[model samples]
Target: MDDTANDDLDVAAFTTAIEDFNRFYIRLPTLEKLPFTTLSVLDTLAYGDGPMRLTDLARTEQITQPGVTQLVTRLEREGLVERRPDPGDGRVVLVHITEAGRRICRSRHADRTGHLIPLVARLAPEERQAIAEALPALTRLAELGRDRGRAAR
Candidate 1:
């Protein structure tokens, strides 16, 4: 805990955790060869609870359908994903992670389970509550930032 910045916010802990996460994720050997766009699409699905339609995912990622299509194609070729027809709507295809994709998700997820979750778990009850309460506002800020950035671009 020496030299730990005890600023108004637990900025050091948060920033260190973020930096460590980025460092580990970027260093993963498999990721070295992955296209950022392709990995982003897979990450969107992995971060969520389930598969998504290309259009829906693309919208969430602020990318185009053709970009999603290309990423999906590459992932499919890599055996990391599969395209399935929506049961109720055959015209709409849902992109799902295959076993390999699940494996990748699990491995990548394991990396976070060690660092971020443990530190978060160490927070006092009230502190955790504060974070929970702040989540919505933070999310709104992030959304606004994204929207503004998009508009600016």
Candidate 2:
């Protein structure tokens, strides 16, 4: 095969592998009853440097403003998040993740990692080493996709 053909095949295989891995990962049991969207929102807040505006959250999550408002309301009710007047801008409200939210995020991460540990342990040493070496590239790929998504929005 020509170089172009070889490259195309490699890209196709890589994409399929990623998709299959995602499908398998999603099937793993989760500790929380919260929907994926809710967990995602909580994770964003928990991992962010600080609180964020509703509009910013909406943009970041690629959801309608009204949808984010509703989601925030539910999260607030559950004591996972709180709204505070922005210190710099009194007119704006910032959404902050509570300790409870952070705890849940930590627990969920641990739960998923726990599930993956045994699966990963089953891999051959060389296979595990390959995955370890690929981490940086995988992370960069994720970052590129996320950046592209934001730019497209």
Candidate 3:
């Protein structure tokens, strides 16, 4: 195959790999408390990198601000997060996961991975290590694509 075609195949393969893995991720019973969409947003906010504006949260999720607001409102009621006036700009509030939020995130992530671990454990040890190593590369690949998307604008 030509180089370009091979590269396209690589992309397709990687996409398929992740989609397959995430299918397992989405199927975990730990997802019961929150839908995947809501869990995803919570995970993003829990990064502790810094507070993100509503618009930024929307952008991160590739969703609309109104959508993010509705999500935050729900999370807040669940005692998973709180909205606070932005330190940078009071008029623009940012979502901060509360202690409960942090606990839920930690617990849920653990539970989700617990579900995944048994499946991964079924693979041979070498295969498991290889999969573990590949995870970082896959994440970096995703970030690289996301960066390219921003630069394209």
Candidate 4:
């Protein structure tokens, strides 16, 4: 094959591998009580700069405004998140993750890491090293994907 054909094949293979990995990862069991959407909202709130408005959360999470509103209400009732009036805009309400929410997020992260460690350890030394070397590129890829998603929305 010509160089261009080889590169195209490599890109296709990489995309398929990433998609497969994501599918497998999503199927892994966890002790989480919250639905995936709720957990995702908490994760964003926990890691974000500060509280975010409902509209912002909806945009960032790629969900409908009504969906986000319902999720936030549930989270607030569970004491995982609280809404407060935005200081800059009285008409706007911002959602902030509570300490309980942060704890849940941390526990979920630990559980995921625990589940992955054994699988990663099963890899050959060279394969593990290759993954480690690819971390930066993978991170950049994730950032680009996130940016593209936002732009598309």
Q: Which candidate gets the maximum TM-score versus the true structure? A: 4
| Residue ranges of candidate 3 with Cα displaced over 4 Å | 1-9, 142-153
Off by over 4 Å in 1: 1-33, 113-153
Local accuracy of candidate 4 as per-residue lDDT tens digits, 66-127: 99999999999999999999999899898999999999988888888989999999999999
Residue pairs in collision within model 2 = none
Per-residue accuracy of model 3 over 8-52 as CA lDDT, tens digit each: 457666668779978877777874477777877777778634566
TM-score of 1: 0.55
Residue 62, candidate 4: alpha-carbon lDDT: 84
Best-first order by lDDT: 2, 4, 3, 1
Model 3 weakest lDDT span, ten residues long: 1-10
Question: lDDT for each of the candidates?
Answer: 0.74, 0.86, 0.77, 0.86
Q: Is 1 or 4 the stronger prediction by lDDT?
A: 4
lDDT of 2 by residue, 56-132 (tens): 88988878999999999999999999999999999999999999999999988888899999999999999999999
Of candidates 3 and 1, the better by lDDT: 3
How well does model 4 score by local distance difference test?
A: 0.86
The segments of candidate 2 whose C-alpha lies over 4 angstroms from its true place after superposition are 1-9, 145-153
Writing each residue's lDDT as its tens digit, candidate 1 over 1-153 gives: 644555556866766976886786566554235566666667767765468888777877778889878878888999998999999899999999887777766665676555557778999999899889988976886678656644543
Better of 3 and 4 by lDDT: 4
